[model samples]
Target: MTNNMKNVFDSSNTYGMAKTFVLISLYALLIAIGMHKGVKIFLYIAGISGALLLTYEWFKMDRPSIPTFFIAPLLFLIYVLISPGTFLIDARLAGRFACALFAGVALQFFFSNATYKVLLSQCAALLTTLFLGVTYACIWAPEMFDDRLILSYRNPHQLAVAGAFSIFTLFTYLSIFSKKKQLLVYCLFVIIGTAIFMTVSRSTSLGLLCAFAAYILFYRSKHLIKIVVAAGLLGLIAFSILPATQQQRLIDPFTAPLNDRTIKQRVGIWYTALQGFDEAPILGHGLRAYSDYDSDYKEAHRAEMVDKNILIIDSRWAHPHSLYLGSLFGWGIVGTLLLIGAFIPAFRHSSGRIKTFLFLMTFFSLGYGLTELRIKSDDGAFILFFPLGLAYGSILFEHLSQKNKTTSEYPIQTKPCITKILTLLN
Candidate 1:
């Protein structure tokens, strides 16, 4: 047997079981993204099963190297339990967070394995194709809300976020394919990009643009300048080709009275969130505490709008629209710092495609968080955390590879099984 093939299949039977469950969790995650129904059931299957199996595997290790970031979730959970605003705690919300965290950690283990990393890349490509096909079907017969595209997902923003995530995944996996397959992936990008544009989500568009720019900057490809110029030209072409209404919306959404009012209301909520933050700067309000003040913020914002001669249409505030603001308000400064700090090690250690992928995810998430909350939502957690776990997994795997002096890098044609899968995909 070839050395690489042995490396791929030499893992203990228990670790193999862990890998199998992790793959199932990821597949379940993709299904959850498209259907959105039975999300909790799927999440539990993914999180609990993978977490338990991975923990077993960890215990079996002679000297397991636990990544520092894993501690962040446990610490955050403790803070949630002990911090002020216990009354505001939502058990379901906490449970969802736990599920996502465990699933993410399981993914970290999956990526750390050389064989599973390649398998994941292949699985992602195949599942993404199926996902985009479904999205295209939905787009073809879209349920439009005020000329906005809502496909499968109840909210247009949800569809947009899904598209953005698919695009990111496709881009990250693009390198594994031959040039012909790469062209096909680019076509998929066009379809996803068109769907995103149809959503008319200003924040998502901006976030995607920022993500692309970050990718180009950090990727440092030989054709960097050419890629930038091409992107600019493509942007202009896309804008010109968009429907007049969408163009107007993209250029200046405030030109429409409804859009103007919506923006104003969002601003008011953000201001109110800041006020909440100021009230409890240290510990902050508990998780979902923003909901407690939702009615008050809406009434106060309604009065402010009335004073400005603006119409009050929808005055309901569920949660702060911004992730950063929500984090601050929910956990206060200490928790927020811990949350951000957790990513520092992963960012520092990750390299190559993993680093690029991490940067794109971080940039897009931060940019999108400016106008919307994602981490708090189930779909958002899957989108944000799973890939994050994969990136960290790569980092940890690299460390192990170096320590053990095994071939950790993804081997293209070393394993016949993987090669056959790639061939089918190509």
Candidate 2:
């Protein structure tokens, strides 16, 4: 076997798997702990480690695929560093985000092929575990049954986690069913869905429904009508059979009104952000600096408002909740454009079906961000970008010749002529 070929098949040196495991484990732990910097630190170490390995591999003459589109964001990140204030409020946050991005890029370079699949598998497994475990506890924990077993009873974080697990389970099913990994996938999905049903995040329920419709309409369009009927039937069965908390969660989106505290707060936040944007239309106040200035905004608004409690209540929540608005508010037109630039390649290369899914995620996030920042924080950032990155990276990798076709299957046997010649010459 050629030296390069030998390197590719080396079981102990699979860069891809390493990257995947690190990313998945870190993300899972972050979600569980709510420590954003911890995740970044982990990635930073992984990136450095991967870069070192990549350097060694490069010496062996293996060609790595360069992620051409990432340049736009990288350049913009640099611009943030050099550009004076009014553009960036907290340079540290911008720098940190850039560091995180570089770490991810380093991972891509170090294990371009293996990371995507491994990350997917990890996401499927980790989310499945969390969902199933939580759901099981809620359903069977005799001691806590009254307080914690029900869906709405769970805290917001749990609800979000459960909702995420639901999506993960669905994706896992698609991955398995598409790839013919049937029995395991089926069992996993059931566990995941049940867990999600327990969280009772109404928005999650809505997102899942929308995702299902999109999945059927585009990817499985031929069986669309039947699938919808089956889904409707399944929904009916689930609501009828499941706990009241679960049922209530499933119908939450339609139930949450504009006057609801959460919704009302989001409106207030939107107005606050709009005012911030107005102060600087071209560039944002600065990345990750929203909360730093929210006090002043709230105080000013309070002076003109009815109640101090209403003006400042729940203002502890940072971020405007909408990513697009947040980006504009923080990074301005430059940052927003850079992000759009980064996403463009993925969009261009993706099929209509894949693109539709991306759009759903992006769209939902936009509205959802108005209430919660799901893309800026570390855990949220990983959750937001990793899967989408994987999906997009998968599309990008598919077009490349180097990506492995079957990770599970043994590689074909072949002689390493280059290695033989190199040894002889040495």
Mark the regions of model 2 whose C-alpha exceeds 4 Å error after superposition: 1-41, 51-68, 79-117, 120-181, 240-256, 307-314, 350-370, 388-426
Report the Cα lDDT for residue 188, model 2: 61
After superposition, the stretches of candidate 1 with alpha carbons farther than 4 Å from their true spots are 1-19, 34-37, 62-70, 81-83, 87-91, 111-146, 221-225, 253-259, 297-314, 398-426
Model 1 earns a TM-score of 0.78
Query: Residue by residue across 1-426, what tens digits does model 2's lDDT show?
Result: 377665665644454344344445434433342222245565445434534543444443345465676465556656556433354455545454554444444334333443434344444444544656457765776444333233332354444543453354345336435555666666666655655554545555555665566656756899988887987786676567656654554454367654355566666777777778888767677755677667687776776544533434544657777766777787677767876776677667655434554655654454445445655555455544443444443454354425434222334332455334222322
Model 1 whole-model lDDT (C-alpha atoms): 0.66
User: lDDT by residue for model 1 over 1-426, one digit each (tens)?
Assistant: 345544554442333444554565556565566555566677778878867755544443434676666576566656665656555474556566667766765565543333234324433543464466457766774434337776456777877877787777677767887999999888878877876777788889878978887767756677788987987787787777667777887766655645665576676667778878998888888757787675665576767757755444455666888888888887889878866766777677777666666788788988888888877678777666655565556665566555553222333233455434333322
lDDT of each: 0.66, 0.52
Lowest-lDDT window of 10 residues in candidate 1? Answer: 405-414
- Taking all chains together, each candidate's TM-score versus the true structure is 0.78, 0.68
